[model samples]
Target: MRPKLQIACDHNDLAAALEDIKNVGDVVDIIEAGTILMLQEGRQVVECFRALYPEKIIVADTKCADAGTTVARNCATAGADYMTCICSATIPTMKAANAEIDEIQVELYGDWTYEQAQQWLDAGISQAIYHQSRDALLAGETWGEKDLTKVKKLVEMGFRVSVTGGLNTETLALFEGVDVYTFIAGRAITKAENPKQAAMDFQAEIKRIWG
Candidate 1:
């Protein structure tokens, strides 16, 4: 299957996010209400997007470390298809969130072992997001062999993996044969001069590689 294109609306305000979504929302398969935007605008932002694009897959990047069930419930109540929880959270917490929502993504940041990932699978959580992080990007880091190794391992372990952080059309070719469930681009799409065309370019690249 073709890798799903996700636009991470990591803006500080609603208007800016909406402006980009207005152009590119129709093209992208998933719309992520980024952590910063959710932090500033709350779950209402998720609801707002849900109202605007009811058919789109809406992800609330809650990055919840705790209060699993509650956060998951809130995100679901707001019409999000998925919510994110940190991989460092306890299995019970992960399971709790998983129970409340249709799907919960284990955000693979900080220190997490494959054993822990296995545990997540055991707990009925299948989605894993391999993030490079904003800090890592600002530090001049880029995706390399190390990142692909981990992503490949997770896919081998029976987890559907989604990759994010500073991704672009050029970088999408790197994972040509890998089964990445989704490719998440935040600033690359939202910050573009022509968001819709940028999204189309991404889709065209995805089709060229995945098809």
Candidate 2:
């Protein structure tokens, strides 16, 4: 399938986050109420974004490792179409969270393996996220061959996969021949001088490669 773009609004200030969205919202496929933003502004931010762009997919990146049901309910009530749960969370928590929302994305990172993904897929979950480790990115890392292998393997297992962590224009080319259900861009677009143009360019690149 063709890849989709999810622009992460990582700011703590709602005004700033909305401003970022205002600049690029029209051109993107999904809006992420980033973990920081959600922590500061709460689910109301999700509600706010939903009120503004009812047509776009809104994701509350709660990254819930526990209390999944509560987190999922709040996100759903505030209008998030998808919520991410850490794969390490208990099966009951994963199930409860999935029960409360339209979709659940099991976030896979940090020693998370294909065997773990098999368990998740077997549990009836259909989506998972592949994030480059934050510490690795801070150390100047980028997606590599191992990342590609995971995306390919996960798709083969019937799970839609999203990739994130330090993804930018230069690195995006790295995934050219792969099947990515979604490509998440945070600082790459949000911090750009002209976010709208940045987003338009991102959309263009995805279409250019996939079409």
Candidate 3:
């Protein structure tokens, strides 16, 4: 199946994010209210995007560390289709957030062990994110075979994995073995000069590879 594309707007200004959305929202399947955007503009950004594009999938990238329930509920109430929590959060917190939201996405940011992922699967949370390490990105690394192997393992475990961090057309090919339910791109699309054209190009590449 073709992987769904999620556009990440990590900008600090709501107006700038809206401008980005206006350019590429129609082509993208999901819109991620990224951590920086949420931190800078708060849940209002999620609400505004939801209000503007009710048909689009809006993911609140709260990256919830603590108070998962409250954060999840707030995002859900504000019209987020999906809410995220850190893998480091307690099982109780995960359960609480999952209970309150329609869709809860857990981030595997160096916190979730294979055992922990299994436990989460047992608890009925099927959506998980496999985030590339920031250190690796800063070092100019690409998605290596090891990354694909991990993602394949997660897919075998029945989790719908979301691949994120420094994704672009050049690296997208590396995800072939991985059943990526969602591919989140931030600067690749949002920072481009022609955001709409950038989105179209990415979508075409996705179709070329996965179709």
Candidate 4:
């Protein structure tokens, strides 16, 4: 399957996020209601987006920690096809969330190890995210061969992984060895002068590489 392209609208303003949707919604496969947006506007934003584009797959990036079941339920009820929780969230929480929804995504961020990723997979969680820190990006460190190796290892272990953080055309090449299930592009698409064009370009590149 071609890797999915998720467009992250991490803005605080609803109008700006809607504008972004209007621009790129047609090309992007997933619409991510980023953590910041969910924190600011709650389920209303997800509902609005669902109302606007009933056919689009909406991902609510809740980043849930403790109340994973409730968060997942709310997002799913609000028409989110997928919702996210922190990988470090308790196993009970992960299990509870999974029981409530069919397509909840758990992100492994901030010190989660590969062992933990395996545990999540063993617990029946299918989707995961790996991100480079902003500090790492600002320090001019590239996502090295080691990162791709990690992704390959995770894929070999039967987990679908999404690569995120500071993704752009130049950095995207580093993903060659990584069987990335999805590429999460936030500021690269939302902050572009032409958001729609940027989304189209990213989608085109992904099709070229993964299709």
How many collisions per candidate? Answer: 0, 0, 0, 0
For 38-95, candidate 3 gives per-residue lDDT tens digits of 9999989999989989999999999887887898889999899898888898888888
lDDT (Cα, tens digit) per residue for candidate 2, span 110-155: 7777787777777778999999867888998877897798888898
Give stretches of model 4 more than 4 Å off.
none
lDDT, candidate 2, residue 78? 94
Number of the top TM-score candidate:
1
Q: Considering every candidate listed, which one attains the maximal lDDT?
A: 1
Report the poorest 10 consecutive residues by lDDT, candidate 2: 109-118
- lDDT over C-alpha atoms for residue 127 of model 1: 96
Error of 4 at 27 (Å): 0.6
Each model's C-alpha lDDT? 0.94, 0.88, 0.87, 0.83
TM-score of each: 0.99, 0.96, 0.95, 0.94
Model 4 scores a C-alpha lDDT of 0.83
Q: What is the per-residue lDDT of model 1 for residues 8-117, given as tens digits with 9 covering 90 to 100? A: 99899999899889999999999999999999999889999999999999999999899999999999999999999998899989999999999999999989999999
Residue pairs that clash (backbone atoms under 3 angstroms), model 3 = none
| lDDT for position 124 in model 3 | 74
Error of 2 at 61 (Å): 0.3
Please list the Cα RMSD from the true structure of every candidate, rounded to 1 decimal place. Answer: 0.7, 1.1, 1.3, 1.5
Order the numbered candidates by TM-score, best leading. 1, 2, 3, 4
Score candidate 3 by lDDT.
0.87
Question: Model 3 off-target regions past 4 Å?
Answer: none
